[model samples]
Target chain A: MTEKKTLKRFASVFLASSLIVGALAGCSSSEEGTTTTTSGGSSSGSSDSSEVIKIGANLELSGAVASYGSSIGKGAELAVEEINAAGGIDGKQIELVKVDNKSENSEATNAAIKLATQDKVTAMIAPATSGNVIATAQIANQYKIPTVTASGTAPNVTENEDGSINDYVFRTCFIDPFQGIVAANFATELGAKNVAIYADNSSDYAKGLAASFKQQIEANGGKVVAEEAYVAKDVDFKSTLTNLKSKNPEFIFIPGYYEEVGLIVKQARELGIDVPLMGADGWDSPTLVELAGKDALNNTFITNHYSSQDPEETIQGFVKAFEGKFNESPNAFHALGYDTVYFIADAIKRAGSTDGEAIQKALAETTDLSLITGTFSVDEKHNPVKSATVLEYVDGNQKFNSKVNP
Target chain B: MEWLQQLVNGISLGSIYALIALGYTMVYGIIKLINFAHGDVFMLGAFIGFYAIARWDIGFIPALIISMLLCAIIGVIIERVAYKRLRNATRIAALITAIGVSLLIEYTVIFFRGASPEAYPEVMANKSISIFGASISSQSIMILAVTIVLMILLQFIVHKTKIGKAMRAVSHDADAARLMGINVDNTISATFAIGSALAGAAGVIFGIYYTRIDPLMGVLPGLKAFVAAVLGGIGSIPGAMVGGLVLGVVETIVSAIGYSLWRDAAAFVILILILILKPSGIFGKNAREKV
Candidate 1:
């Protein structure tokens, strides 16, 4: 009887210790996870507004669109550095609270929530991609946080489906319709009568760009000979390219990201369809040239936000600074990132406060803002009324062709 | 003419499926476990080839050989570490372990190499040869030739060699074969090594053909190859080859007819229909469940 009582006492003690260990482990692991999530940003838990103003950067640091996210992050970093060096927005240094969305839409929303609630950020800079920005913008709106995107150019990003403006959502880049019209005008100028479009059906950005480009092409009196669609992450385009070859269109328009576009170009060329390929800002990555051989890029063109070859003084200065810092040429996404930071800072300066409502009003009233891309102002729908640059790749070099104004 | 062109495209794609299917079939024939991680092994093969070409600057043939050899070792290690322990466990246990290994390898690769798709460098001069108004690239021809050669070699090893006979004996009955002095464990390891080597070759060919490699690249191809293995009769060698070709052609023709969205769905639909119609598969033999 004494031995049994001792055994029961031992069992209870063991259970209590196990529970304590489990709780300790859970606490440490949760802490570790939060630390990793908040590691991308500089300041953490600075809710007391006096020391520094916390601005959240929700970007895609890893996944399919990681290249865009990384570049945009670097550009934002450069802008933050320059701003802080120049006595940061009314004597309060801006502290960027960055979070990687892992190139996922759902994660973007989560990142936004964490930034708004957990980090207590004053304003948030959203992701570059339209799909991700659209996903997170709703959360930002619900939280009444002024959210600005660097390059989410889809029309519905700043506007609702019923054509209502999103009060908290704003962008530093032009919309898809403007980019599509620019591409169509460029193609028409090249004397193309009929064109084929190979679009990514799964992506909102691709479908949006393709639809607008088609509308603009027909409006310009040019016929769309063949239209083909493929989902993202599809590596094989031989069958579709083969079918397109028989149609023998004058040119091909691929409005998708660089990863798919590069493979499509290579496959199209291999199939002996030698028509020039055109795309939108999605083809601004260096991987495009690497994937599609340098020789294959001779006749390719893209409607970009900024060309690294631009000789404008403001653009040149940004380019030189970006190259010196990142040791790589800045693409359109980089310019947009730089512009997004400066735009947000300008709004804060005008508002004279870091309050969400104040920033939103100041952002809506933004005018005559000179950015790396172009001098522009935020329109009624919170999209920039800026010009798009047409970049032509000749012999592997991306040369600035011309600018198209909205 | 369009049909003919799609047919060529199908053959090219089918050959890759076939190469991958051989590994699945052979591994399943020896062990009842569905080696779900076989696809990731193929993915590793592609990465090995990528490093071979980009980092080592080696020729295509040498890279192919190196990848195959390295994958064979990897397969053996995976079998020894993960499968060997579960050999006597329930079928469900082994199957679940396979899935776990698959996830482990995929995420491990993602952790080491970022999830972005890397461009596979052009290792060979690309030249297309037109036949009857349909174009076939030299890369396609090379893939087909290599698959055929590997299949022939596999057949020889399984049918004629001592190890092959021992493998067949072990597959018939592991305990009985061990009683008869055959090293069942060694035979199982050999089967895994051979199967993994074939997967490695398929990876290199796929990378060369697609010119894109990512951590998740093996998922779809692996599932399709599993379907191919099922369509051809899971335990049959010749069945896998024929099934892969048919699947490739059907997918190509479906896409050619402007139903590209249904391309992935078609493979699963075929799987369901085959399961409903011929559960034993085209080449699968109907056998009673042992007590």
Candidate 2:
């Protein structure tokens, strides 16, 4: 009986200790929750009354798209550095609160709300995947947080059936339809008649590209001979390629990010299916050639926002600053991220305050603001009205194919 | 016609799953460990094959052999380092350690490979051909042929070899086998080495067939292969192959008939249904408690 009592006492003590530790850990976690600032200025304000400007970033910091997110973050950081250096936004340096959502939709939505309610961010910028933005837009709308997505091109992000954009949601990049049309037209102009479409069916980005390409192909009296789809994690495509072989396409149009597309191109080339592959802005990565190898990527064409080959002074200046800061040429996604910050900075300045409504209005009214992508003028749907450049992979290097001013 | 074509594709995919399941089942049969790192080893094989081809300019057959050898060696090392220490601990400890090992290997690969999907070298993947009323490529043929050959080889090794008898003895009664002067430790390591080698072969085929290799490539396929192992009766050799093939075919058919959006989630749903209906799996025998 005495031994039992002692054992019970020991059990209770252990349980109590665990409970205490757990409680302390939980409390510490809450205390250490992400630091969020308000006031469209940097946290390094010289005085308390200077009004803090909080710009929240919901990005994928880890996962397959992590490279894109990190690059975008670097670009955003660069822009903030420049803005702060140029006497700040109305004498207030912009403070960026970046939350890594890891590309999950629900996580991004929750992070958006956290930034909105807990952090009280004045505005938000998302260089997120399409699926994430689709989920986060509703939250942004609910909280009335004006958001600028750097590269989410899915039509669902900002559209209603009535042809109106969600008032609070805006994008700094061209929509998918715009990119798709440009790719299709470019393909047609190149005299490619029988084209194959390989897309990531789960992604709205890929789906939108496929649909637009098919429509444009049919319109131009060209045939979409084969359409194959894959998901994000799938590493095998033999069966899909085998099926595609029946169609005998002249060109392969793959509209997905570098991770899968590089492999697909390499695999297709290995399978003795040698045809020029075409893709969207998703192909604008140094890793593409590295992953797919120069031979496989040879003769491939893609539409992009900016080219590292751009000799224009404005573009060269941004590239120089980007390289000078980050020590690498900024890809198109990085440029969008950089341009997003500049766009937001311009909006904050035009609004004359960190008020959310004023910032949204200023963003909507943005016109003729020259960006690295091109001169930015927000369309009625809040997407950038800009031209796209065509790029070709030759000798394992991205060369400017042609410029399309649409 | 397209729907019919998709069904066939699903079955073919199922066959690949089955091949992977065999390795999972074989390892679990001997040690009752999940071998969570098996898929990554398979991925390593693919990368090894790639390196062999690109760096050494080895032909497909030679590269494949080299990949399997590397994978087998890694497997033996994993067993010696990770599994050997946990023999006296609780089963859960071993399971957790296995998970830790899996994560360690996966992250290590990711750190080195970066996050991008790499293109498989062209010599193996590019041949487009039509076979049996359906268009198939050279990659599909090679993958299918490799899986079949592995299955036959495994059957031969398991049913008709002295090592196979030793393996069976160890699985049935480890204490008795040790008492009978069997080299139990070496036998178990060999078992792991063989199973992991098979997984490596699967990985190379998958890489060539898919045409891309990425750091995160193994996670989903690994999970699905585990499910296939469980579905086919975890300890049964033939069962893993059958289970994998069935699961692959079911996923394909479901996506072809319904929407492709639910393709990934469908595998779990089927697994749940199967677990509910047949707790011991389709071919699993009641395991006698060792204690």
Candidate 3:
């Protein structure tokens, strides 16, 4: 009985010590969390009288499209830091009220609500993808705030299916149909009359590109010999490639992300289908070269926001600044994101006030505003009328081919 | 000719499904537990092989052997830690725990290696061999050969070894086998080791075949392999092989006819049709409910 008592006492002592350590660990972690949130942005207490211009960034920071969202976030942060450092727009510091949408539509809506209603942000930068941007567009409009999407290329992001232009929804990049048209024109320029389209069935971005490419290619007197669709996460595209090979198209347009496109290119090449392949901004990832290999991606092209390799003075200067800030060269998404923030700041500076209505008018009237991606004016549909650079993948490197202007 | 090409593609893909199905079938046959984590084991195996080939620069055979051995050990540990105590409990409890383990493994992988996919280097020379107007890559042929060799080796161990005899006994009647001095726990662990080892091999070949490896890659393939095991008459050895081939061919054929959008749905459609038409499966014995 005496031994059992000793054992019970020891167990209680151990439990007490462990509980104390657990509490201490929890406290430190919470403190670290607070530090990160504070360092990242003023995620809390952005009231109207805060003497700072609150820019709501509803982005995909940690989900399926996290890479795009986080890249844009970094660019936006850098742009804000530069603007604040250069003496804030109209002498008021820009408080970026960043929020994560988890790459989900409903979460994006919730983020917009939290930013608009609680944080009371004046202008908002939308999600990177089209669907997430569309999901939050209605909320932004309801709040009378103009939102700029960095890379949401779908037409429906700025316009509804019924051909109604979203009054307050604006984007800093060209639409999906524009990318498809550029590829089609590029194909025609190469004198390829026979073309095939293998597009992703999962995303509106790919489907939109496919539809526009088909429309423009048929207009250019090229016949679409074979049209096929593949879902996301599919690895084996051999059977489809074999079927497509029989049709004998001279060029193939694949409007999809890097993940599936890379494997498709490799597999198609292995099957002796050596036609030139093309994709859009979705294929602008280093993962593409890794997956498709240098040889397989030899004859591919993609229409992008801007090429960092461009010798344009504005572009080179922007690239240098971005590389210095982020320790890496800026991709098309980063350029678009950086340009998006500058786009808003330019509008706010012209509007001469933090008022949403004034900023909306100034943004809609944005004309020939030179930014990192390009000098662009907002069209009636809120799409940026800018030049897209066609990048050819030669020896696994994206070589700037030519710039196409709409 | 195009049909022939599709058939080649189907067979190669089917062989992978067969390998993964073997694990599910064997684990269920021996323990009467649906090891949902079996698919995640396959994913882990691919990642292991990716590290083996990509990081360590190990040759194909050594990488294959190393991946199989490591996965076998992981399989045994999963069974010991998660499933062993629940062996006497309800089957539902063990199945849920298996699913939990599967999610844990996938997320743990995702936590370490970000969600981006890693491209597997071409370990084998990619050369096309045309037979009867149907072009087949040497990579596909190699994958088919490795799968066949593994299946044959699994057959040899299952039907010929002392451990194999012990497995058959315990699967038939665990209580009776335990009474006869058979170590049930060790036999079960061996079964997992063998099964997971095959899954590991499948993962490596899959990486070579598709050349893209990601953390969440196991979920869909796992569910499909389960469907394959069911179609093959769950718990039946030979049934899993035939079932996997049939499923692969049907999926490819569906995509070949321009219904590519319905390709993934085609697998589940077959599953439903089989369950309704042949609930006992193609090779399953019609054992009545004991209750």
Candidate 4:
């Protein structure tokens, strides 16, 4: 009877400790949520009487694509710092409220809701990835906040599949179809008659880019020798590479992210299949070089947004400032981040008020706004009509090859 | 030539699966419990090998040794702490505990090192030697040789040694063996140590061959290895090796024939077919239960 009582007491104590832990976790997360709300509310509450404008930055600060998120966040923060240092936009200091999406689509939607309903941001800068932007764009539209994505390049990101424009969704990056056309044209320029595509079937970004490239390549009188697909998170590609090698295409296009691309390149080279590799913007991470080995990347090319090696003064200035602040050279995503913040601020300034409707109008009417990458206008679909830069890997360095204009 | 190339590819992949499957078969041979956390130990082994090479600048052989020793110790500790208490409990309870321990290790590793995949630094020069117009890398040859040597060593230990006799005796009837002056717990710990050591060696080899490692790298391969164990009658040593090789060859052939998406599905299909045709597996003897 005594032992039974002790067992019951132990069970109760265990339950109590777990409940305490659960409560503590809940409290900490709620404290973070409320801090953002209170801070945003206090700043914007005085916006009508004062010179402060609140903007929300929903980014993937820590997750699968955290490198892209953190780089883009740093770029946006740098732009904000520059704008404030120049005595603010129209004498109104821009207050940037940053929220991490944790690199998940569900978390991104939650971030949009929190920023819109609780923080009451007049406008928002969505996450860099296309999938995350699509996830949160509905929330932005529902909340009636003007939102801009710096690097969401999927075609459907700004336009619905039903041929209707998403007014609240805007991007500073070129769509995947344009990038794919650029790649096909570039492959033709290289005098490649036949090409192979090893696309990541699991990613919408990779599949869209591959489809576009294939269509354009055939239109430009080039034959797609073989097409193979692999799901995301697969490291082994020997069987697929071996099958593709039998076709013996002149160039292999892998429209996948750095993680899989790196392994694919390494395995392909190991199989003694030594043809130049090409990819889309997904191959623009530092981790690629470390994984694929510098020697393996010597004959590779990727279509990118901005090359840091650009001799243009505007690009140079941004690169220098970014390197100074981050202690590392900025990639294409960083440039998009910097350009995105300035783009949003430009709209806010042109709108002449912090009202969401006014900002949305100004964003739609943005024209020839010069920033990093190139000077272009936002079209009716809300995507930038900018040039795509083709970057070549020469002796382990990414050099600027050529720029293709839309 | 294409068939030859596919065969080489299959063998290279199959050897790694065999190395991991050996651990599962040996542990199940002794203890009735399936050690589900064994695969995570393989992942940990790879990380240990990676750190030994990247941080300490240790050579490949020394790194392999370090990973093997550490994982063996970890295997013994896991058995002592998690499995020992639940030894006499219901089979379902022990199985649940094994799964719980698997998640605990996977999440703890993820908590420390984020979920990003890391590149295994190239420690050896990768050179391929062509045989009958099929290029085979030196890495594949090394992996196959190591796997063969380890299997032979394991067979010798299990068949020839006095400890091997004690293990077999304890596996047959633990309480009876204990009554006849045998240490059942020590024999079981020795089995785990040897099995985990083989898994560690397999992990290091896999890292070298694939050139990438991540926290969750072991999940699919682990499941495949489990299937291999089951296909090879679960507790038989040679059966695990044959089953692994066959699974690897079938997967490679499927992918080579333009069914890359069905590679994983092909493994399970073979498993189901084998279970239906020969329930005792390829090398397993059909023994009637004395209930």
DockQ for each candidate? 0.31, 0.16, 0.42, 0.41
Consecutive 10-residue window with the lowest summed lDDT within model 1 chain A: A27-36
lDDT of 1 by residue, A255-337 (tens): 99888888898888777778888999888877888888887788889998888888889889988998998898888888888
> lDDT score, residue A367, model 3?
95
Q: Go through the candidates in order and give the C-alpha RMSD of each one to the true structure.
A: 7.1, 8.4, 5.7, 5.0
Error in Å for residue A281 of model 3: 0.7
lDDT of 1 by residue, B1-291 (tens): 767778888999999999999889989988888999899989988888888788779989999999899788878877876788788899999999789778877766665445667888999998988888877888888888888899899889989999999988988888899999999889999999999999999999999988888888999999999999999999888999998998998888778877887888999999999999997789999988899
Comparison by lDDT, 1 against 3, better one: 3
For residues A200-295, write the lDDT of model 4, one tens digit per residue: 999988999999999999999999999999998887788889999999899888999988998999889888888888998899877898888888
Q: What is each model's TM-score for chain A?
A: 0.84, 0.82, 0.87, 0.86
Write the candidate numbers in order of decreasing lDDT: 3, 1, 4, 2
Residue-wise C-alpha lDDT for candidate 4, range B162-224, written one tens digit per residue: 899898898788999999999999999999999889988988999999878887888888888
Ranking by TM-score: 4, 3, 1, 2
User: Which residue window of length 10 is worst by lDDT in model 4 chain A?
Assistant: A32-41
| Residue range B1-291, candidate 3, lDDT tens digits | 889999998998899999999999999999999899889889878888887887778888898998899788888878876788788899899899888788777766655455678899878788888889888999889988998999899889889999999998988889999999999999999999999999999999999889998878988888889899999999898999999988889888988888888988999998999999997689998987656
User: What's the TM for model 3?
Assistant: 0.89
- Which model scores highest in DockQ? 3
Each prediction's whole-model lDDT (CA): 0.85, 0.77, 0.87, 0.84
> Model 1 residue B13 lDDT?
94
**What TM value does chain A in model 3 reach?**
0.87
| Total backbone collisions for each predicted model | 1, 19, 0, 0
Q: Which segments of model 3 are wrong by more than 4 Å?
A: A1-54, A80-122, B286-291
